[model samples]
Target: MSAKITLIAMQVCGVLFISNSAFGQATPQDASVNQGTSASQDAELEVLTVEGRALSLYQGNGAVFATRTNSDIDKIPQTVQIITQELIEDQAAYEISDLFRSMSGVSYLNYGIVKMRGFEQESQVFYDGIKGDPFRTFTIPQLFNIEQVQTLKGPSGAAYGAGEAGGAINYVTKKPTFEQENTAELRLGNKGFFSGSIESSGPVNEDSSQRYRVGVYSSTEDSYRNNVEEDNLILDLGYAWDFSNDSTLTVQYTHFDQLGERLRGVPIDENGNFLTDISWNSNEPDDEQDFQSDIFQVNLEHSFNDWLSSNSTVRYYDTEEVIKFHQARALVDNDDDGVYDEITRRYQDQTRIYQGIDLASYLVADLGEHTVVAGADYHFASEDEVFYYANGVNNGVSNLSLTNPSYDSDISAYNATLNRDRLTELDQIGVYIQDQWQATAKLNVLAGARLDYFSEDYIDNEDNADNTSYNDLGYSVRLGATYDLNAQIKPYTSFSTGLTPQTASDQEDSLDGELFDPEEAQQFEVGVRSYLLDNILNLNAAIYHIDRKNTISADEDGNTSAIGKVRSQGFEVDALMDITPRWVASINYTYTDVEADDISEDNTVYRILANNPYHQVGVWTRYEFPAISSSIAFGAEYVGERTDRTTSYDAPFTIQPYTIYDLSWQTAVQDWKLQLNIKNLFDKEFALAGFNEVSGAIVGERRRIYLQASYDF
Candidate 1:
């Protein structure tokens, strides 16, 4: 260890010994265990290590349910993927935005939006099963307070009421624990990185029945460009009362505000292929601008009993953005190709608002050897988005021709591009109920359904498309069965459905309205899960095939269309093992095949979104020195190459895989402990993301470093 690292470790040890007098502490297991290629036997089992990676958490059991996941991939009755908090720490994810780049079965676009299963993320997120859309102008998922992030695949309209045709992401917030808990973190690295946060959770009463938790995070950093920068602030508060009885109530609040430069995407040449390698339009003078958002939300949960509970929520948000992009493709074109004739510049300004409430409850009952569970919920939501654009018209001296300014320059051209606007608004309501029944000691059956009503309208002055309104009544049904394969294992099978409402349906050849269908998906899946080796090990695996119709996507005509045909098939496995005292590890893998109707179609090719990868794999592990415990963690993880993408009508952009290594150590001295981290140890560069509209892609980051000191109060 370096001199700096040695000193930090000494300080960390000092604080740990000092703090022990104050108090003590803290998983989903099924999700962590199921990823192994073969969970075939009791002898090969062990607890896994996937913590703080996604929505997964480290439960009191020390089992890494790391994804807040279940034992069987089929447990959720839908496609799912989780990145654990452990994985995030291993990869040195400073901003939650950086986490998406290395995850499999998912990809990022622009800045923070994620695309899953061949479709862009449109409607799949839920927090403990509640609505949480980061795409909205007002809401942003703050990572410092996040426990895990859960992604539910396919249309969620059935359960979430109204949803995107694509999918969604839910960021589970960290909650308070019975034991008094406190932690502090500091990170500094590439591109002028710096971040710090402090959190504490403990009892509010002597009996330790009531508890409170609070956290705050702040960071100021610059972008890849010399002139661009970012600054962020986040605050979170939470409380819960156990009353040491049957009833419990919990409430939590969070806030986020950020300001940063607008980074426009690189442009493409006449052929629509990448024209310049990795170039910024202009870090020029008078070309600077900023974007910002303020977000706030509150949630309440009350439990009537072990078998029943209900939840409610309230939220508000605001945002603004200003950005500039130089048509590098146009500026480089020496030929008078028509590609540079019709479009020059693109600019937009937007405003949005959202508000909602939810009420739901569940019941669990037992009869004979049967366990039956039933639940229902209702939600009301409203949202709006408005955008204004200015076409590039003021560059003057325009022949608008990419050809060098020649004798024809005297001919005046339109001084500026067109000025236009666009806006979208929606109102929605939903209700649903589900039940699980055990018919025999060896067999279990699950069934459920949901109903939703949604109304939406959009107006685009740019295209003179106004008040285009759409509405729908949608429903979904699901069925599945579980059977104990033996003393330590169970295998299961499930079938479920989902939907979404989109005006593009009116333009479909079938024009299947609500009566005909809202959109459809029927998934067939089978998997197995086991807890063996004295509860120290767990394993799970599953495979699935999905048949979907009424899928919303744009067609070759540049007109929106619900293809009524799209398919995704994949397999996944997760595993974790407490192989031995102090040594822990976890792994997860997914492979998907996407087939869409627009694959071979002309103009619709790009609109169909065919460029995303098909295969994904992730693995991570850590070990603590048993002798010192504080000897600390050593870890690494990898995201495999992508072979299939649904972009440009199936034109593929296969990305090679890359792995990341991370290390950390902490020890306490007399009054405090110090810590240090090194991320992306090898500085591997891999594809982070890209859009079909352009032939270019986003690249991941290089090496980063940080060191910190903490002293307990």
Candidate 2:
């Protein structure tokens, strides 16, 4: 069934392209209408006044956000998806993951972890086009101060720094506006959930040359999982000064405090059946994961002339995280019983502190028919970490029973011993340049290249004999072309390469002092984009293949090697339509196939990548009634079956397919707005494939309902 659906989707995509190409010889009136539609869409967000305020440094142009180029998106040959503030508000998204349902080829794992295309991404997230956030790995990303999100699919090493082949996500934060605006909101939900927030932005002086923005948010919730709850607080403050008509300087400070317990998921039997309640938590009652962060940033934008400009940012970050948890190591049967009776659990405690500084600057020049962008960035980061652990077998602790569990045991009884203490420092410098040129009346070409130098100094405080340092230089390149077939259709093709550096820790258990090489990735893509139905419907379709080499793996002796290879290919479609005066709808679908070579067997066999589905679909529709100033919306997501492939498991396990639905309503009266949302409306019971055999399967979210109220002044 999955293969059949994939075949049909390919046919549908081909047909759409063919039909649009055949319409290239349009009539004069049709061409004129299309020209108007294109013009209107191009100027949609160009001008901002009292009613619509600019949020970020690049929001005013609308031409450069994700790619950092002055060229329009239609002319760029990469797949870029943008989630607007209006859509974010309509969905009432609290965190970045909440908006993943509307994006193509994207999936949420846990916390800030995400899977794009077919590869898992943990450290690929960015902010304002810059890489690295101190707390990204420790805490969930809140949306209170974020203006929009841009998903750049495919290898972007040439434009950004080192990254995987899957893609990257950039969060555009809000900036100070010269217009006065203030809002206060409160929300209440089931499961002991509550939240409150306040935001204000306006001018600091009578001349409006100086602007200020401030926001405060707090929330607490007891999640669906047993013994899992979270409390969060966030604060943002920003000030901007227009020192000159063509130059601006902005300063911003942000702080975050988060407290939560880890959700390790429930164990499953060999038959792919849950061994206990889905909500069962393996962590102890006192286990907690806490994160605290502080960030300070400065941005400066200056126009050298009508044809040249520069944008630069310097940021400093400090963060700390502490965690203690119980992890299920493996399933065991005491006395050789046919049925699994005992589970090996490990208790662990860790503390880490990270500090970093990042600097990036870009110069954009418009030279006749070509727009050029050149930039350089520098990053310096240091981390101090300590770890302690105690395993059931190694410590002679009693194993927990699989079918029967007791939570009354004092966690202190399992005394964890010192494991490792480490301190590391990393420095990276990158330089890149790109040019977008109009080769012909209907042909646009883009080419870019980047070079990076990175060095890592690792020190094992516990044993200086284990210390190691490594440094290397790497390069990436990108080339793409787009041809406008007609007013409504454009076809494009691109080839790009990416690289990810290996840390010293990845080779801790290696033999012969053999260090691993950086992973290399390359992708080839072809796609078509169209504006149909007099610009009421927008559609984009693409097919791409990505190959990654030098993936790290371990051998039977626990020796690490970079001999693994993985490949992923997929077809995607995204469409947005205005069905009528009061109706709006959007749909996206993705079909992915991924295979990885078995490293343990010396790459003799290929296995399907676990935790990723072959087919996924998303749909959303909304209707508005002007009479009551209200709107209602419906959303649905479908995930196809997946396989759990791991050497520890005797055989491959299959995870069934599932679908989830959501509904929401919003209304406005005077200056007050009210909203309600029901997620997982049908309360479906489902589970997702986990990282490995030991991690087990994760339980899906249950039904949740919430109400919100906001007042504007």
Give lDDT for model 2: 0.77
What C-alpha RMSD separates each model from the true structure? 7.8, 11.2
User: Model 2: C-alpha RMSD to truth?
Assistant: 11.2
TM-score of 2: 0.88
Q: What stretches of model 2 exceed 4 Å from their correct place?
A: 1-63, 136-138, 332-342, 393-404, 507-515, 554-561, 601-608, 645-649
Model 1 compared with the native: what TM-score?
Answer: 0.76
Clashes of each: 74, 0
Model 1: lowest-lDDT 10 consecutive positions = 60-69
- Encode model 2's per-residue lDDT on 484-603: one tens digit a residue: 988789999999999998887776756767778888999999999887876566788999999998888777776778878889899999887767756777789999988787455432
